[model samples]
Target: MRQDKPELRNLSEPVRFKRALALLLMTLVLPGSAQIVAGSKKAGRYAWRVIAGLVAIVVFLVLLSLVWRSGTINLIVSPTTLRIVQVLLILLAVGWAALFVDAYRLGRPLTLERNHRLTASILDGVLVVLVMTVLIWSSTIVSAQRDFVASVFGNGEKSKADKGRYNVLLLGGDSGANRIGVRPDSLTLASIDAETGRTVLIGLPRNMAKVPFPAGTEMAKQFPNGFEWDGCGHDCYLNGVYTWAMGHKQHFPGVKEPGLVATQQAVEGLTGLKVNYYVLIDIAGFQHLLDAVGGITVDVGKKVPIGGIGGPIKGYIKPGKDQHLDGYHAMWFARSRAGASDYERMTRQKCVMTAMLNQLSPQKVLTKFQGIASASKEVVQTNIPSGELGTFTDLALDSKKLPVSSFSPVPPLIKTGDPDFELIRAKVAEAVGKSEALDKGSDDGDGKKSGTPSSVSPTKKPSTPGKTPSKPSTDVDDVAQVCKA
Candidate 1:
């Protein structure tokens, strides 16, 4: 037989009001706890079971994520998981809101005086609104994540690290109305340690002539000597390989992006580092990413021209300390070649990359998630499997704490016009060797010298002429120091 809690109903106005708040807090913390203590045991036990099941599920997920990081990451990106979570959030919000109302009923609100009813009613209402608002907001963010993942990342095969490092070819594309396909203006091989996320930014000068193609690839057979076909005029340089490959797509049968494939192979051939993946970001769209992050602060060592590469000079990102560049000027700052050497611009680009990588945080991403996600869909294109996002995300967080090293074949070292392939490879090996040494030093200091180890900030100095302390004869270490103004 069911019986009412006469004591609860017979309470004085002050006591009833206090009981109402206590019941509400109990419901907020554990949905069925208040019911078990004061309301129907049958109903409370059922709700208790449901709440217990939910708690167990959450605990299991947390444990799984800690044990199998990649699997948890894959689950997060999976459409099925996202949709299920979305549906569950809606259902939970509805059910929990109902539970709060039931808790109000259990509080015996109607028996209280009018003013007391108003106060308790208002408290219950606020709790319900807060829960619903937060859950709905969460669902919206999850939906955004689903859309972003679906649009940007394909279910491609995962790539493994080569000798404990991922060598990704990052190409800055200049696909304007006047351009044919996407021709690269900046080429860099980002060699990152799989464990520590230590990176070496190997900058390939845009004017670097005679870029090599990997052996046995169709491009190798086509160009025989290098990426230097005589009839193409100035398009024979490394940056022009994309357009040339696009034009000769017939040679790369079944390839969706022959240009990208050719450029990857060329980088592999030049650096002697196997290219695992390629990220092509259209420089024109690069502005949105910066804008999304509220722009980056840089030390402008020299005047960077805007819209005057081969036309009339419209403006200049004048020399200054702590210069904040919006998307528009940031784009020009990275791509501007007017009154600046190609190498100088590459140095500036490095500074920007370092800044973006370090300054971006999980909190910032969450706050400006919509803008960043929208920008990424438009500006970034890559073959990296979405499943590996967790691994890379972890690495990026780790990388923020370390200094970034760079190697560029400029004057006094290997001239861009006639780069010595052997010398370029040798210098690459030396720079990588230095990074390895740095890893060893760090490990020794941190008390883990046994393991074979591998592995950016905004606005710290800008080297003169945008020249990183990189002498043609010497490698540059910690680009942030070189560019922090």
Candidate 2:
């Protein structure tokens, strides 16, 4: 009885085709959009597409602004990381657009089934949880980085100094189990004179004679109320002296004991300058820091020998006038005991430190954040507050053009026949800038008296004519006082 309406039937196919294409586009976009419902259900669903277009414009503007500003966003952070994050945001945006369209098209509920809303909600919640977790971790790392920077720049007496004036105590150690509680292998006092724009590094010999604590300190006076070292003939190691000097033993548990105080006093008496601050770095850290800044280039004076029982682990570093050294080989070369003298080691250390200074380029600074962080975190232990840390970082970053001079105390301060105490005092006074008649007592522009030993103190034992040299002083016992000063 009923005949098919040919016109109506013919129109259905093209309409279905259009709807299918639109649905496909919506599917592609809605997973990243917020849901929206309005207008004629079918026609209004396109509203999400319009919203997405607007969102795309906003994001474009933001990115353009970031590029224009040229901050860490443009220079420091990894481009690949930025790209991935951007892509995710784009995908999420697209997903939301699709979600919005689907919501609009579906009317009351956003699902194929009548009661599938709960499942959809669960999936959305899961996605949110994942996204938030990632954001949290990202935020934590970013904040940590910011905090580190802040620590370096914050204002405080400890951090206040002219742009060019600064001091750093450099400590080198074997860090081996046997070497534990022993003397540090190398010690250098580095000073940047703002007036002259020159850097001076004075390397100290490990066997320098000194007491661990001075007469007044309670610890020194109380030892056995102490017995004579002549009985044992055992000299305290340099590191032990530093430990006692800083009073680290009393404040930091397990570091306190008898011998440590003696070590502190010895270093003080030798240097004639109060030690303000120190940074202790081991062989591993030195190598890692070098690699972090890319390999360093050093001028090898001659073929440095390697390998021997008494020498630092053996290997031959070919003689060369100049060469690029990677971390591992560099360490071997720096700690090489081939010549077996502190002077030889000091020369190597200078070459390496100088090379490292030259290689600390801005390109590396921005690109090697992870490596730098790893290196610094592992090796650098200091009481310098976070605020002052930022200032020092800025200074170091700007110190590329500064002229640096390095010397071992042998010729002038530690000649073979020089009295041991005089050598120690001369070197300390030299490093403290008091030995220079002109610079004596002059304010370093910071209300405090110039050449005042920051906080380092030393004590020394009487020299035994023929016995092995006494151990260096330990300052760890006075650590809190020194740091506070």
Candidate 3:
């Protein structure tokens, strides 16, 4: 056997203990640091390279997120990128743990006093376990995010912005447990500015009759005069488009979801705006999403009935100022049709949507991302691609500060029994144009009012400038005006 090292045999207990603690501390702060000071320069060089690479990666990501947010999001959602990151994290854990072990070795543990040696061993072991566990946990979350994106967005067709705007159709899909096909109970077209994220919400009543379709599309060819059919005898309302299309998907070949596609066409034709994407929300699963963001605060104008659409009223979400509602109550608040008319329910639904958008923050999303993503995967089906998620994500953040403008083709404006498609389209165009002007005015510090309703001219005053209007809910010029209060 080789002779024992002379330094180890000669060192005092205090000196040895002090040296051991110093090595462990330095290694904990900067891996391979202890080795460079005392042991293998070769291993230390490798660690320094790793540290440099990690620093470079962090800097690059920071810049990327700032300059090209969508690219950053694409990487995060890409399964390939996530898988590579997972492997790298595993390697990093092992290499980092090895450095700690090596740092402890450089301390020459054999020379330490029994108590001091035990203490150093314990600390080094704890650090290794802690660091490894954290990285592994992070890797697991990355996996979860990947799965969530895959399940929710799927491989939907990407749509281009039309006239520098994105028109997305939002439908509240009502598919009963016993129903054959889903019916779109609620309909709203969200026409968003591609660059500014300023939005115009155009609400279409479910009972709107004889909606037109695009000129060359299958829906138009099938019903050239508009969305008309003898089966319902022109009583073929807008909501029935989904059920009708689902029962006849054969006509819509190459379409993954004929019901959704047909509905998109109808909305596009009726509004004269190109539909870029469609989000079909399952009504029953909506509660889970509301709960994930820790509930929302809404002004309940009247007593909202619960469990009364087809049965006895179980309870009431009492009217109050600034009421905070949980998932269950919020869902019922949007769905209940007991004492309220369908149009009233539609307005309430819009209010709920506006409140959620205004209140949901990046901090909340980050903290509750796992829950939100899980609920979203179940609650939503959409044609929005995963690639544009980052762009929309940024837009959503920008929208939180701005107001949302809305228009609904309801009475005092148009007849739902026999809608004026041409007039409706004109109103839609006017609403969008005024919203754009509103955005421009805000930029030039000239515009303060939101998009005016079709009935209200921009020159006309909404209410007294100083006082809040009591019935802002009826006009719905600035959705934030009513929903926020």
Candidate 4:
């Protein structure tokens, strides 16, 4: 009689119902979730490695879904999303830490019952899965950001035509803890012509001052000198203008207020040409990009001394025509400011860009694809629409079929008292051609007033050697006169 009493049913009626309900929900949820959670079983059993693999797979699937669904970038994680994700992760980690501490102290002998071990285990699993899901989503957001950033273009009209012709403003951002603010270490305009498949590069001197910016009160502070602009005196730093434009009212305006957009506008305003796009990359990222591209071969063209602003940073570039450069040294060459003018730096920047473009074969850096993409992701800000990336790639490929000749808008010619902005404006107009130039100025490079030309030659090369070569004269003009002219 003692042994034969039928074994009691395992669960009470209420408990049974609860368990059944939970099981039903799990069956609905966990098939999809567990598949994501379990991942594929591999040979290795390192816990961390397994977790990382699972995370990677999940992120990949999510991103692939976004790409597939949108066919272009339509989903962008707002700045708010990043903050929420970060805060949530940190809070979860803290809560888990507290639980771990409590378990260590109270659950003596690590028995299963007193602390409800099964319950704790379920909580841990659920939290981990939630964390993993969030992390995967976060990573998807980052990838989307990079792909979209690299694909956008600002030249509204140019983009509409589906031509390769685009404008890019390259800003070398100066970031530091104690500095007054971020400044553009370098500023340059890049023009890619789809029909001609030619790339025209122009560099702007950082110290060139008195450029127009919207005053803080005008037209809701349109730009140039609005609330977004943050520089002392009249004109803001070329790079600061971008920071102001994108997220002037807000600290981080996600990617919408990327400096490139404002730069495209400013360049358009100043130069009278529609900029197709813009790219802002930090010095560190630039170095990485250069290294990732196996460095670049540059023809120095003149003696480049490696020292700057009183020699705190030191390196030497010997006088030579062409030399191979690694990442570190190449940066020094491109950013060197010691015993040099902005014009010289501009020259170096163009050289680096040209060399990079010539050697920018995706095949060579396939192994470092992630690094390249990551570097671009962290540092670059642009307006290249994701939809146009394929078209851009095709255009770049087609460009290789044609010859690329390096050219610049003629340096403004000015009298001792007159500034050369109008002259510069004229050169800019000539650079983009009549139909493309935005602000057709009075001077057209030909010593005549209101003249227009297809292009301007800064110097004329002598056909014969040893004869006194004839060329345009560059008379010394005061900085003020040069700026205003």
Which candidate gets the maximum TM-score versus the true structure? Answer: 1
> Could you tell me the lDDT of residue 164 within candidate 1?
74
Each model's lDDT: 0.80, 0.48, 0.79, 0.49
What is the Cα-based lDDT of residue 114 in candidate 1?
90
How does residue 452 of candidate 4 score in lDDT? Answer: 46
Clashes of 4: 25
Question: Which candidate gets the maximum lDDT versus the true structure?
Answer: 1
lDDT of 3 by residue, 28-98 (tens): 78888888987888888899999999899888988999998777877766777778887888888889888
**RMSD after CA superposition, every candidate:** 4.3, 13.2, 4.1, 14.5
What does candidate 2's lDDT look like per residue over 1-485, in tens digits?
Answer: 43324643454544533433344344334432222222245434465565577689668757864554223233323334444554555555445444544433432232234334444444444444554555554544444455433332222236333333555667775656665443467777666553433455666666543333455665455332232244323333344455443544454345433333343344444454444445667775677877777776665545666655564535577755447777777877777765556566765676567667767776776667656766766666554444344344444554556544443446344542233555455554544343222333344554433454434322223322221111222211111111110
Which stretch of 10 consecutive residues in model 2 shows the poorest summed lDDT?
A: 476-485
TM-score of each: 0.89, 0.54, 0.88, 0.53
lDDT of 2 at 438: 31
Q: Per-residue CA lDDT of candidate 4, range 31-80, in tens?
A: 22222222222311233353466589668757765555332123323333
Ranking by lDDT: 1, 3, 4, 2
Question: Of models 3 and 4, which has the larger lDDT?
Answer: 3
Q: What is the number of backbone collisions in each predicted candidate, taken in the order shown? A: 5, 80, 0, 25
On lDDT, the stronger of 1 and 2 is 1
